[model samples]
Target: MKKKHHRVALFAATGVAALLAPAALRAQESGAIQLEQIDVSGGPAQARTAGATAEKGAVGPIDARQLLPADLQTFAGSASRVSSQDLANQRPLTTHDALRNVPGAATVSDDGYGRHSGISLRGSPFRRSRKVLVMEDGVPINFSTYLDAGTHYTPPMDRLESIDVLKGPLVNYGPLNNHGVVNFRNLSPFGPKETVFSAGVGSTEGADQRVNNTRHAHTRQTFDNVGVVLSYSGLNAGGSWDAERLGYDDFYGALGIRGDNQDLTVSGGYFRQRDRYDEDNFSGTLADFKKYRHDKKRAAEAGHFPVSCGRCYEWNTYNADYFRAQVAHNLHIDSKTTLSTRIYGNHHDRARFYVSDDSDNPPSDFVMEGRDRLYRNYGADSRIEFADLPLFGGVTHTVQAGLRYEEHFFDNKNRLGSTNERLDFGNRGSLDGKQKLTAQSFAGFAQTAIQITPTFSVVPGVRLERYKISFRDFDEPGNDGHSTYVQALPMLSFAWEVAPTTTLYGGYHRGLSPHIVRDVLDTDTGYIAPKKEIGDNLQIGVRTKAVRGLTFDGAYFHSDIRNYQFGEAFQSNLGDRVFSSLDKARFDGVELSARLDSRAFTNSPWNVYGEGVYTFVNSKIVRGTADGGVNVAGNEVPESMKHTANLTLGVEHDSGLDASLSWTYRGSFYTDALNLPMNPLDVEEGKVKGVWLLSARASYKVTKELTAWVSGQNLTNEFYVSDRSDGAKPGVGRTVMGGLTLKFH
Candidate 1:
């Protein structure tokens, strides 16, 4: 009966897609827009095609209004983009949801709102708090201290104004540049300065409510600029799964201030988030005697055993606080010299807790665990440009240099005890541990662009980096260690303006991601060893705006990775121990995207727009010590979908009414290292079929200051598996949400 219900729901969603296909095709035809000319800055016009400097007319210092109507920066490269308009339109409750449209991205959820969420990019081997880099307003958030248990926390999405994502290890001006980079650009203090407030309520597992208020004020008479934003949310409800467990609640807030002068700008902010959740354990197969009988018929036949039928409750909590400040200054030393310097500092404190079997049914055992981690980071970066140099045909050149330093401290403690003291079986004890780690690095790069002709240009560049890591454990001696590594990255590229509407470009570069505290820490000995990863990537693409209202961009890329980090499981008489290992991997893929903006009727009130993206990836493990040297060379990388696509269609009018409908689909994927067969929980074996998601939203203006909107997501009530692992169940079923917005200036 359960299988039949699942089939019925799948068929219904397919029917809806067939019904909406024609309308989507028509919308695509009416809303297409031609691509615009790209602006190149800093380096010679020819060098813009290379990685030398940003394009001149490119949208620097993003603005809110420009985010609408599709901008070139979003499509400049195969990677890197953040659409403020999309964020406003989607109003995602979590950061993971906001990144659903990015290329080569996937997310897994441990719970609602504030549970564990993990992301995989371009088939990187990192998982469960490893390898990835996250930053808040240019400040590194990862601790440099020794191996820590809890390093995977992000600020609430509501406090962020934009998110910038870079898919592979790329050299950026900051610490913690590992597998990928995600920069959370918080709301800045600028503009006319206004006060805005909003409140909302929704239904999911239960009831939810949120309120947000912000004040932006500035005084020209004073040399100081200040801004503050505060928000609060509450959730009290039942969950969709099991129907017996309750949901969780989360609260977060942020405050920011800034000051600016003719050649300098300084800003700082503070943020905090608190979360609580009820944990749910995974149920094994029915054959296992310890498994709880969720089936009603089985319970009845067994005479309703209370211990095996009752629900269990677990409690978990997380609290985090972060503060950051940065300064940027422009320097003028010579007629042809332009330079800029930036420096920043960041500090964070985090605490987490977990409690199992809170009710202690059947006098079962209960356990509690907690951890605290603190981190501090500092960095300084500068870029200089020298134009019309006589060294090479009077070509232009740019030099970039930077230095970064970080300090981290991790203190972990765990205690276990039974619900009843009489049942204490020698398992009740406490363990305390502490570790410290530090990282320091310096980098220098130089690139020059040569203009050979009016229509063609070439640029070449190279960068050198030196990194050092040191670790020490206060609780254990003989665990102190230090390691250092140096690397050089070179890049070259060329661009040709073949026609007024066509541009052809290509480039090749080297990248690296260094191992940190987590890579070296031995769970038993509390000792760690440093590891490093290096890779090279090649890319070629063509961008065109041939038609009057249609623009397209496509790219092909291949990356070779050496010394990749992986986890290995070992069994001992004491227990099972998992340690980090080194392996080699490779990733290759293609991506294509297009946007169309058009007006069907010159005088009509209806205007249509459409945007779409398609990605194809093939990632594999080339060499590894396990598997008897049998290469799993052709298998698709774990968690990376073979193909993914999204399409959006909308209509707008001059009268302040806008409506849009969107569809997204993700291909089947694997979830484990071995890609084993015959396992129901194996993502690669069960093969979660592709799903079509449909959402529609519309807005109506009540007055100049207020506007109300009604939106529905997953209207077809599609039951799809967003993520799955060895023993974890997929995400919840269909969800529906609505909201309203107001402006006061």
Candidate 2:
């Protein structure tokens, strides 16, 4: 009977959303970096082909890391970006690897392959990146972000042109942009039939680490008014743990039609991956981990996990597929007013097969636990911008407004498996329990930049959002209800261009987040009654080119977070993993950074360059955990890094030779809210210590179209822990790779 209800609900929601949704409306400049000669008034250019670069003026684009501070826009707060050049310079292989230059971003990689990444901002919990809005271009990358928000998939960096990281929601972006927004901008399509191809292989000195290969290709074509672009990236490699492996492939395709007064872009993506998840650990005591901290001779001598001896070599297998589509249109309404509309849909399926170490049970019996999760969502995001308006002063107001309407669905089945036929609902493999959750949202926002003076501007914005969700538990017919959330957020900020090359910025905003649906144990309270989180974000910063060769951006922020949420892991009645919630917390931090190019100070083709970022976070438990005995009001929040710093120094010669060295440091952090040590030295697998990693790279251009490079990570062979959960997760050790690329123009 419940199955019948689930099908009906899912079909109805999907049908309506599909019919009305078009794709993401990528206005020319909502929050993207502006390329030289491109009209900043226009949103992302539709005329540009996919994978095209700014060098061609057709919108391929560059990253933030490639821009000088003088080129950055004067927003209320700092927005950081990483360019394709920076990515290539570092020879990145994972999402985290590509983002290594961004400040204040903490990528807590459980295992170094980046199958599962923890990106936290302002000291938010590192799991699932619940506080950050991760997007591709202008569309949400995760299906039903409010439902199962995890790092299920991250588009390969090789096919991307730039990545933009903004704090809070942009006026044109849909809803739920409280903490931060990270958007992966793909390479735009270039016209005249252009193709770009590249490939490389890497090896790491760690247990089970193997030589991995990464390949990517992009092509663009234009015929009269229509343009098309297709790009793909694939990876075949070993997981960062013992006896593990991984495979991933993804593609992005788009079609654009440019007209005299209007333009349209339709884009789609599909991603697939298979990974081995090994959780073999000793988890015994501090002394035990100490014995293996420097042991790289082989896979550890032994493990203390609760699994059979022979079966201990096993682990879970994860498989996932994600699909997304978007249609964006821009209308230049007589130059002064422009309209942009985007309709998008995303659907995904993920499953994990559990393998146990039970000697008494047969291999077939060991695979009795499994998880299947599904998500579907479609919506329209619309925005209209008035380039210049008559407000307090003539031609001084740049105003914009947007609206979003979306429908979403989530379904999951985790049970004792009776057969290998999983994921599909057919027979459902001895379903122990099932849940079908659905939601719909309507959001609206408006903002205007009031130029109070030639060198100063005040921007004020507001976003209103409302959502209704239905939660149904198939096992218990009565355990279901409707959860509703509504929020009106207001923001005001100012940017003062005090000098020719300096801008002072500051802002205060009210933040809002929907009441999330949690997968909790039956014993957990407020499972269905989770409340929406609310907080205040305040920041002040500066962007300046004070010296001929030096540029810097710095900021300090404070947040009074209220009714926030934290997950507490627990075992359910069926021995399944579940999470309950912790009610309130507070996070505040400081971020500082600087960049330099010697050409400005000394007119020479032989140049020196340097950049660095440092962050300090002070997070605390305000309302404490749900458990009655624990009073953690004054303690530091779990996994809140005390300090993090990164620096890079390099030299570039006119001869086409470049070399750079980078250092990354992370301060110690507690594993849990208890603020207690798990090791005899006051730290253990559950309490992570500080870490420092060194990296270096050099590349030489044989010709303008061909380049050769060599790179190394953890060059010092540093030994450190990344994650200290049930067991320790080691950081990526020394790795070296050499590759050559040839580009035909």
Candidate 3:
């Protein structure tokens, strides 16, 4: 380990020792207490689940067929959880690998570092992860949901307690509820007061033996009433085939406290990372990709590390600061009714400096671009849940209603090089233009769970939202616009207990995705602004634990998309052109997942799990354009994948040794609405080929406080392509990493 990392680790470890000593001494004085242990082999089949870590509920852990309030569990929809222990074991270097198990999710990275990773859900556009609602403990992280939602800030997964994934029409949640929700919940301060720490060092190697090293350290402490968690992670890495040198330094710190009836938490993060845009596809003709298949290092290697190498400097730097404060209070108001109120404020500042990619005129004087942006969002939310409400027609009802007021402001400044060409970016560029947006939103929602019988329940929900936006263009005052949209979203769902261990659920809801300032404002050409995206979502699924030791959740989903538009490259038998936006698409998909614990079934310490998602997009262009492009009806949807799946099988011993093998498949996706190459000058395949990879991990617990683990990624070293939009960026190559974990409780 480098001295830099050692200093970081030592600093955190010293704090841990200082805190734990006193806590341990006091516990000993008061008589030590320990958690109960469930012996898997000696108990009945049902007892196996007592300590088993499987799916998690919104507030607590849950069993497969258990019943919970809609707010406490995912009802009439699909959801999943990944625990903190799982993240520690994998030590995933990229966000794509961290979310691989989530069905109907596809991730693309310009570089393996996940600096600006894009997460596409159910055929959402593969741009910045704009469509998905990203929240840390239900608080927004990006700038503005409707002004500048696209982002470059993602908290490292290592600091999370668990990740909650909900896929469906979240009619009960406001803001961007159309696509889906992926909430990364941070660890809270509760239970025993102690400290936990994890540190690791590893490396990844490509087919030609090129390697990139990685190092990370995490520490968390829980005092009696106050808790603190600090994390510092750094990565010095390079790409497999692209050879893009990258460096990253991220710091996160949060202070939280819990009381009997009130809890307050505050957290903030800062990071600076060098981005390596591997635009190798723009290097040469199609034959170049095939000729240098094994050894292909392109323009990305020019300016990342510098070292006096005056190759057209393309170094891109991104910096961001994130801070959020949340306060919550619970009032009993009686034994059967409770009122919970939460208020939070979030502030973000981000900037990106880089050379814009010009595929048509590469190797010439490139355009230097600077993107500076600001985002501020604050909101207050209050909800009251009645455990027992008035009954109607001999049915029981548990109702909850909430009101929220949210406000946000955003600013974007773009600067371009003076001559459309620049060698050194030290010279300030010309201000191309600036855009500003102000938004205010008020929302209220009510939902009720009516238990018709002991075995069946029905839920109905409704939400009213009033949103207004003001957009101003600095250069063109005439292009300024003010838009206000008021609408009501509704949902109806049902759950039936078909058997003791099987529950069937289905729901239908109207999902809405709000439009941002860029998508809502008119251009200088008098172009009509695109409307917000809407989807009528329907889903049906069954969660079963009928078979002892086996848990399965299978579902079928369909989304009717309307008025959703995005930039797309289109090419048919006719000439090729890139449209500003494409519209009117539909997506249909199905997912199946299962998990098994062998100990419950055969008295053996083994487990197996797998999940698969297949989405079919019947996308078409309902509107036409005067531009000579393929926006005609019946055209294929751009950047939509037909199939994607993941499977895993693993085994764990009672003595704490475990091993797992996983495989992921990404199907070929079209790059244009016409489903053909967009390069009319040289017609080629427009689809980025599918990629298949195998990953394996093995870990052994040598003692109560020490564990060793090793991870293998892309073991087969498969030569595959990931994205073909601007250029072909290849998939991650083969790599191996190992590390140790230390814990004291």
Candidate 4:
């Protein structure tokens, strides 16, 4: 490892030297070239042509281009904005933690570290994740089975460069855009002149220790026109709660080749996590305890009775590997047309382990415990575009179309242990089981934006999708079902420059999401069915540089979900079985944001920027059934917070130093779906309350070759629970981390 590190360092230094030598010679000949003059709020060309507008608008109004990563967007569009900086400010370790500030969004967790976090969008709960498409660089990451479970096991946060979240049915991108879409773009190859390395360690609850290390290097001359980036991270921590301990490791790398007018990029990565934790039983109610106090005491003394010995421990593990490759060709089909095409493929594998045990001792008799599962996916995608259409009003239009194909496989196994002499029971036969699932889907979509006027435009688009599924099991007779679904998702949006510094926009769209095998499969009865989801979304917003050194954007949105999916507990002689069904829901919300950027803050060392956001949401289950009974007509949805807010202030200096402070708040919420009184014995209900968190970070450059930074999260040491299924367990506490970076160039 030491030798490899040394070689990488040497190669980085050599590449940097090669780039600087030529630039230094050119600088000596030029002698102090002048700097370009332009407005900071808008691009150079726009600033030069719209000087009046620039003066009217804020000094540095939020730029849409800045909201997205440098290489991701094709053109500056609407002001709906969120950025990587915002995510970093939140210090999110899971996707649920990251979406806390977004409107109409909430998260539920069955385990920490994203092991089983479920995302609810626009009031839809427990629906097949296929309803919400997840993509990496325009390629679908959800397997052919159309489920988001992969995220719980193989979260891509460690390798993400940025995340772009689009709310509502966004058909323009492709099929499977029903509830919404989250697009994750990976970090690109760095320049030859840069190298970065960092390491940090911290402690959590229950004597848990967390440590991580990362390295990034950009080489410009490794293969004439090639550049590469490699990164690796490992995390291990003991549980803050009894019997909770977990560890994970991840690796990622990318290589790219740049030609005079074209680019090719290839990347691959892997992640693994192992966890062990105790499970708590929810049936130990206070009434039962009061009634059985005497019996419980006697049982405890004898050590033979189960005093709610809800003390079962569990072990879980997950592993995943993925590979992707993309190529882009820039060409001029003719003097009037320019075209670009991107083609890519992805492959992923996953495995999981689960174990449960009761009391301090293994069962004296035959014990039932352990489960194992495996999954794999493969897919390919392509996109092509034609620009500069010669037609009505000298308009320019872009048409995009693509196709995707995927396959999935799954396997499951169960284990039972032999009985002990004390139980006088014989060993039970072990059960080996396996199941396979396969699915195929195809979609084609197109959109056109016509320049109706110099300052106005209209975009109209539609998409068509067809899908099928098949299943087989080796252990028992497997069931298979096939259904064809077609949806015409239509969208129309308009943008008008009301004034040089202001813009107004509004649009309505139709969206669809397909159900997953889990949603349709009956684990207890071996029954299968197909489910579909649809919704209508409407939004209106205005953005403007209302004053000097300030920019403001706000919007109001309403989404009505039809045939939404929710869980129903079925009572049987054996036990209770949970199943998925269609339910109606409505989600309405308002979002507002403001940003200030100025160099006028008391002669600060660097530019100063401040931002704030507030969101109000109302979510409810309009119609549904639970446990074979009608649901209340006006019940609020579980895990939906009424209000959320965020604020941040920061400064970045030219001297390679930066600092910032951020605060976040979430309103109180009810944990149960029925909204009934929580069991008195359940500590989780009693612990519910609103929460506030504060964090601060700063970094300083020691020299051109070295840098160091420190961050203090949850500075106030606030104790709060992010979620509680039955009883309350506090979320993470105050954490502090410090790290140093070394640059080879």
lDDT of 2 by residue, 60-159 (tens): 1212111122235455566777866677666665777666677677776655457665777767666656667778867776546555556657778766
- Checking candidate 4 for backbone clashes, the offending pairs are 59-549, 684-727, 684-728
Clashes of each: 19, 25, 0, 3
Model 4: lDDT equals: 0.49
Residue-wise C-alpha lDDT for candidate 1, range 587-704, written one tens digit per residue: 7877777778677325577678887767776877676543344455555455556666777787777777778777866666654345544244322133344577776777766777
Better of 1 and 2 by lDDT: 2
Residue runs of model 2 more than 4 Å from their true location after superposition: 1-71, 168-176, 190-193, 278-282, 290-303, 309-315, 357-365, 393-395, 419-430, 520-527, 569-583, 626-628, 680-685
lDDT digits (tens) for residues 1-745 of candidate 4: 3453344334333432332211000011111111122233542233221111111211111111012223211122322323455544444555555664554454544444444435654444422243456566555666543432334443435445556556632454544454456665555553343345555555443323344222233222235556666767665554434345566666667776654333345666665555553223223444543333213223223332222222223223333444544443222222222233344444554444322334234332223434444555544433333333435665544444444444444444444434321110122225446556555566666655455665665667676666665665555564444556667778776656677656676576777666555446655666465666666777777667746777776667777767655433221221322444437667787777777887653566668888776767687777766444757557765555667677878887879777878787755565545655444664334224567778677777789877677766567866555555423444555656666666575
RMSD in Å for all candidates: 13.0, 6.2, 9.3, 9.8
lDDT of the candidates, in the order given? 0.48, 0.64, 0.59, 0.49
RMSD of 1: 13.0
Residue range with the least summed lDDT across 10 consecutive positions in model 4:
22-31
Cα-based TM-score, every candidate = 0.74, 0.86, 0.81, 0.76
User: What is candidate 2's TM-score against the reference?
Assistant: 0.86
For candidate 3, write residues 458-535 as lDDT tens digits: 778888888888778888888777778888888887777788767887787777777656644456564244466677
Worst 10 residues of 3 by lDDT: 22-31
How many residue-pair clashes does candidate 1 contain? 19
